[model samples]
Target: MLIKVRFFKCGILQCNVVLNEGDIVTIWIDPKRVFLVKLAKGKRLDTDKGYILYDDIIGKEYGDVLKLSRATAYLLRPILEDIYLDLKRPSQVLYPKDVAYMIYSSSVEPGSVVIEAGTGSGFLTISLAHFLGKEGKVITYDVRRDMQETAKFNASVLNLQDRIEFKLKDIREGFEEKGVDAVFLDMPSPWEVVEKAYEALKPSAALIVFVPTVNQVEKTYLEMEKKGFVEIHAEELILREYKVKEGATRPKNVGITHTGYIIRGRKSIKTS
Candidate 1:
């Protein structure tokens, strides 16, 4: 919610946060499926079970259940997964699981200046904008306007357009920003941009790269080390979800397993 909200009680679900207009709400049909809806006065969410009017639940709290014609739905606060789950994908987007880990382990915190190369589908772009707070901004580069436009639309969905600067430029020319907090590269040849990233990062700031293959990891790590980056290492995140219930809580059969390898390095004081 954009406004200050206090504790508001609901019938079956108790919550402190009140739903507001423009707040992205998750309509939970079941554990396996959910619909992310942006709340608006006249917006109607058409579901397989039933249609829901946003006006009806604008003032309600999360965890409240909407009585539908054939089922009861839960109104939930959208998590990080929910936000990206509903994005418009024009290409193979960076998985949200890896996005979370990269941001968490990187130097790109709230209010920090960050440079991102290869703005593919804006999954990582929007995620960075959302967590960067009002003080921070993301300058993302891409060569394709269509992809960049799609990314812009996705960012607008969360009202995060103001926090991001979408630049339609080839990153191979090098990032325009100097001494930024962090540099995240999500391109096929991230090794090619290590020198550019090193040039753009502030001293001691982190440089993170995402690649899907072992050879890519090897090349990126070698480049980072050769560029005199310190604390160089790589990690791959494996996320498994569990179905929680009274007595049937267990791991889901299949989920996000291997999205990419995250290679990290800190800018060295001595440029080699």
Candidate 2:
């Protein structure tokens, strides 16, 4: 299969390389290596290494080697995580660490109904929409029209526009949907929406709150407890990356150490 290669470090350069028949391709690329990429016919790519002919890679296998004018070699397929992280965002976005944890903890599935507040940059919204698949629904609310518009563009790019409902309103005042499977709050004062979230979630539904400060977490936890939420807990994730090289194995000096705290709980069943 012909695959496109992108450099995580270099934001501007993308390589389209062809996979010759009967060849196997690795899906990962080293960020530091220079690559010559083939583009579609009649397309050209300019790189610091040199100009590359788009036609050269038309029939190569995914892992086949391609040479740039500078003789630098590059792989054909790049990892999906690299592409996701490199996506352009109009606003600050939730990191993958937080999104993964939310998806796992909430048990988001093919038919889940997910409600999200403050869809900044639409990163988490896109992820959740993908996880929910065709049968699921993702309803996201934001007060800023520009943010919502930008998020719509991002979702469309991912082919998830049909699966998501973008509401240009503040979730703090209220929401339109009820009986949701999961609720994700990424707003500044998530506590303000706790009551509305409780009303919207189905019994025992998971609720996840993302806040950047300890104060916000504390307030949200207190409100959740007051609202009769069960199993209330907060956690922060730190990603420590390690360099993998022959004879050298140690954590990278710098990694995604801290982003924010996540507070999770379930709506308690009300007894009459």
Candidate 3:
């Protein structure tokens, strides 16, 4: 039953935790390749490389490796990326390269309050919750019921539902909460909500405007300026990964470019 055993004694436990039914595990095969499985009796995992029976992994230590027919996979704990990969995208979600920078630039931190509009697929909202820790809260607004429901389900799957509040009202109606640390707008015509975002944010809080086209950026930027925001800036992120080889390391041809432009501005004390 043991495929590749760790250095364990015959009588005592090798690790503090053991794999059991109803527990989620991350199966690691290679770089950028992983699978999440809910361990249960009589269940099996099939992959192009090979298949793994749950019976083999049910009692194994988390760090143990299991040999398949043609490959080996390591049993490890799940992480935020694992949860992100498993989301059901009802709309185009923001890339991690952009999400990380946007959150960091907006000064969103642990225990901070955030408000975001047009919660597309909940990827950004989920990322915010993960970064903000348990003491933080995210209020996400979406106009469509279906999209909001899907986002709620995705957050629940990742066990982040408690950190987020899903609202199905149009963001143009204005947000209910005020004095938040940050406000993120991802919907069309974020320019229309600039004043509303200004009202919701605390004094000197950041407002991030995300849009797909330069024209939209211009419109949003002008509105932000006229709305009395200060220290405004905009940026676009392009991520290109590289294939590493001992002799010929080169950048990959397929790079994620032009996902969107992120514009940041701070709420002015004059507005408060």
**Regions of candidate 3 where Cα sits further than 4 Å from its true position:** 1-23, 31-33, 38-42, 58-62
Question: How do these models rank on TM-score, best leading?
Answer: 1, 3, 2
**Is candidate 2 or 3 superior in lDDT?**
3
Which 10-residue span in candidate 3 carries the lowest summed lDDT? 4-13
| Estimated TM-score for each candidate | 0.89, 0.80, 0.86
Best of the two (1, 2) by lDDT: 1
Model 2 regions lying over 4 Å from their true place: 1-29, 32-45, 51-65, 71-80
- Which candidate comes out best when scored by TM-score? 1
What is the per-residue lDDT of model 2 for residues 1-272, given as tens digits with 9 covering 90 to 100? 44543222112245554443222223222465433332346665565666555466556544565666575544555432432533568787888888889889997788799999998888888888877877899999998988888888766644468889999887778889989999999999999989999999999999999999999999999999988799999999999988998999899987898899999999998666
Indicate the residue-level lDDT of 53 in model 3. Answer: 91
Inter-residue clash pairs, candidate 2? 18-60, 19-60, 19-61, 20-60, 20-61, 25-63, 39-54
Q: Show where candidate 1 strays beyond 4 Å.
A: 1-18, 243-250
- The lDDT, on a scale of 0 to 1, for candidate 3 is 0.83
Q: After superposition, how far is residue 126 of candidate 3 from its true place, in Å?
A: 0.6
lDDT of 3 by residue, 181-266 (tens): 99998998999999999999999999998899999999999999999899999889988889889999999878787899999999
- Span of 10 residues, lowest total lDDT, candidate 2: 20-29
